[model samples]
Target: MKDTQPADRGAAPTTPAPAVVTGKDAGRVAFAAFVGTALEWYDYFLFGTAAAIVFNTLYFTTFDPATATLAAFATFGVGFAARPIGAVVFGWLGDRIGRRPALLVTVVLIGVSTGLIGLLPGYASIGIAAPLLLVLLRLLQGTAVGGEWGGAVTLAVEHAPPGLRGRYAALPQVGSPVGTLLSSGAFALVLLLPKDDFESWGWRVPFLLAFPMMLVALYIRRRVEESPLFDELLKQDERAKIPALEVFRSAWRPLLVAMASALLGVGGFYLLTTFVISYGADTLGLSRGLMVNATLVAAVVEVGVILVVGRISERLGPGRVTLWGGLASAACAFPVFWLIDTRSPVAIVFSIAVGIAVLSVAYAVSGALLTELFPARLRYSGVALAYNLAGALTGFLPAAATALLKVSGNASWPVALLLVGLSLLTALGGFLGERMRVKDPVATG
Candidate 1:
């Protein structure tokens, strides 16, 4: 849907227009978004890493080894199932109240749930209740994260000068890699422990750290200014009464495009990292430590890719960069798995790093592209629903890969095919989204 001038809707403007944000304020907001998202993702990724390596044994001990791993992966997917609900709830809050308040609530929810996971008892200690509690906490995390990206992207992009929207949007996207680095690094360090100690308490250490990180994120997020566009909406009393409903009613096409644009970043990432970790360690007979370290290296590579690609997006446009990135990733899908199948430590790391780097080109620009797809009045709900819907649909990729591996007699080709399909879907999104982009009334800042 094309963006239109805000209608008066019979209410007279009450609040004076907010002062223009200085460059310094913009930088602060970007930093705050980065920090807040990084913390939230760190918590989320911790569960993924643990699901691959720890939870199968600890929480699903009643099942056989293979079934237990599948069960653990299922729990990981459970969080994704709850994300759309979070998106609707927080997206409404963001659209109705303010971006800053919605973000603050999300950070708190994610942090508390993650920390509680650290303290939770295992199946040995609590029987069936253990997995149940894990699922409940995961649902909370899903809800929090569902709300996190949209608000952060909306806030950052709204604050950016038109010419620099790509770079500003990429700043918060950096959090995914940063979060991966922190979570994977934490696991890498703790993996150095004896197997007994590592399984017993080491995994819990990283999760426990979420509490303090949340506090820091909260402090920073609270200080950041609200989105200028959202502020303008507030002054005009133009908030959508039911943003989720409105998005579906008038913005379904962009919503679908956004989901397609997001699938590879969400699905393909889990395939390359979370599922690959399980595949490498459990299936390929690779060292668990080696697999975790490979992801750590990939996380480092992704950070560089995002920074460089962000600047490139400013020149090439987000959609073109995203399209190119997706095509490249599709081309590399088979080779990535082939390299990992070699079972050499160097090859394993190289495979994951390269895979993530290519996919990251699209991911880095997604924030800018998604923001351009909807008007400020419905941006939060539309972006959150689209992105989180993709997340919910693909959250089961690791488990699906696990199942595919079994059905294919342990061949990696089926999984590679899955990545190729996801990449092409992403490419289609970038193509369509660019062609149908909504003009950003406030982007000129």
Candidate 2:
């Protein structure tokens, strides 16, 4: 049979399709997505903070002092190495049974794994086993995040009303900044403890905090119904039984575009947010608390600007906004680091905040745009793989940038060029994806 599906197999249905969200239900969907994603991101950002500040000293001290830090960062990146498996496993479940169940599983996995990290014995206590167990936990965390992002995005994008998809979709992206704020705040407080206590036991507080937050997120998620689009899909018998298999077979074009579209945005953010912490603390001799505060400020700006860009995308189209945002990111690439070099508190916050703002423009609209790349039957698998594929690489971004800096005699130019290149790639992929969407009538909604 001819492929009657949207171009690149990514566009919305050509027909009027199904309308699953009403006014009240729409808000509920977005809120549920936000809460769940916030929990996941809290876990993610917490680990990143720990890796940058404490993990090397605590868990990987077998290596030379400098090597321990790199090892710690490498372990952090290793977490992403497991995400592709997660995308496949959870993606299959989401496509088959339901999005809600799959997402529920992801949250539980992340919460349990994260909490256990608090209880794990450090290298001083457990020797080789310490880092070994830490690696295992990070792998689990990566998998959970791998599954969480795509399913959470669906909850908002698929439920959105026409002309409002941009803003509604952006709601889930809000969770990252919220997560960043909470994680940084938690660590900032922990740092206030006496040095011995903070080193010995205080670092565990943030990881333990996930347990309670997870319960709250779980309760809210359980109450929220599954995606309206998936329900319509069920009624139509269009759900793919082996969506992971089908997506690879029929959706490679859109999948390629999706991967490219997600790459720079995800990687650049990690380089900016996570790696910046290490660079500021270890290289620049900046106070850890000060860098954390700067990152917190950036997160705050990200939240506000993401909301605004979501609205702007409603009129200008996500592709245009996203492309421009990428250009904006390229522009800020060197400035952000230059501000850090100056080590001026006010300038640091402005630089990082502006950097995050530019990043969010593409991020805020990514869910809607990526979702449009696949038909509903296989969307879970398609989006999951696409997003986590980016995760697979992005997780290593900080380590890569760190190594580049070291190799270049601590020059920031290599890192800056990497940022600019990734931004341009994002622009190119988004522009092409947008063109495909516009050519397909059903995807316009």
Candidate 3:
């Protein structure tokens, strides 16, 4: 597709001419994006929860407590490392063919990988082969996830009315917290089982549920129309020959801004939920249920935050909302840790919930901000690469935080500092993103 800049410089650069979608069509598209994303993330987050609570013992049984946990987390990080690979592959397909086809493939890939995880043998039965298979499946999950958010965000944003893109885009972002709630809730229920059963069979139920969830997501996704912008591109015969390469060659700056903006949402989330859950249970001697419950509550809070912020961003602008949210999260970093350090259940829950809420403010508008960074022809590749590259970089945060905790003699300072750094990076990205959209014709185009 010929890359064209918006003619009206006074208007919001990302706001294209309104698509012809009716209110019902827009809602259906947004809902489809939300459902498919939620299911994909459910599969993804289940692994994080399992790494903290189950994989260390079952898959890395030969190691010491600390080493085993680290190993499990390493495997958890492996999925993240594979995300960019998926991004490239699916991004290419989305840009070359259509967003709907790429999304259908990703959902199936994630569901199958996640369901197989439920059926796989652990180290007890399969020895080293168990962890190897676990890593392989995690890679597939990561790859699927890498392609998921970009397509979901692009489809929703492209389908939205000019002024309502933020709200429509935010709908897909809501899937993150929904996935968290479902995954954590499933784990909480399974945790109530007898110890042996919970370890052997109970833990697998959540992963197994992916089969049915996948079918539902697929059905919904199949009903949604292709992105209106992609349809325009098709009619115009404007598809990029190599979308990923084009992004790197011409849109590298926006890609960087997107990655920086996306880091806290990806990394900060893992730090709060995955790392904190392990820290609470293992280091502070808190009950696992307490930790999981805290995340469940936080997930609920995040859903509200995302919806509220999405609406606000439509007025204030997504970049400004992201900047404000990032700054707020940075300011809360120390207090969040201080509260967690108190070893009180109420304090822990409050800390986690409040932290997630603030971070979610930036996260909620990410789809709108990112989609605006690239023209429609390269939107999938650009958005997918930016978001998943950030995922690849920060996917190891939980494992890194665990090591930092041990290195700092269990002090929370290092971890808090890490949060501060990530929040600041996001703030910078938001600041630059808004300015770029205004001043850089390439990005706006």
TM-score of each: 0.96, 0.94, 0.95
- The lDDT of model 1 is 0.91
Candidate 2's TM-score reads 0.94
Which candidate has the highest TM-score of all?
Answer: 1
Q: Cα lDDT of all candidates, in order?
A: 0.91, 0.83, 0.91
Show pairs that collide, candidate 1: none
TM-score, structure 1 vs. true: 0.96
In candidate 1, position 127 carries an lDDT of 94
How many pairs of residues collide in each model? 0, 3, 1
Candidate 1 lDDT tens digits, 308-412? 898898888888887998999999999999999999899989999999999998999999999888887889999999999999999999999999999998899
Instruction: For residue 388, give model 2's deviation from the true position in Å.
Output: 0.8
| Residue-wise C-alpha lDDT for candidate 3, range 1-445, written one tens digit per residue | 2355322234222333323554558888999999999999899999999999999999999999999999999999999999999999999999889999999999999999999999999999989999999999999999999999999998998778667888999999999999999999999999999999999899999999999999999999999889877876676666777788878977899999999999999999999999999999999999999999999999999999999899999898889988998999999999999999999999999999999999999999999899887888789999999999999999999999999988999999999999999999999999988766521111112
Candidate 1 at 364: error in angstroms? 0.5
Q: In model 2, which regions exceed 4 Å deviation? A: 1-19, 438-445
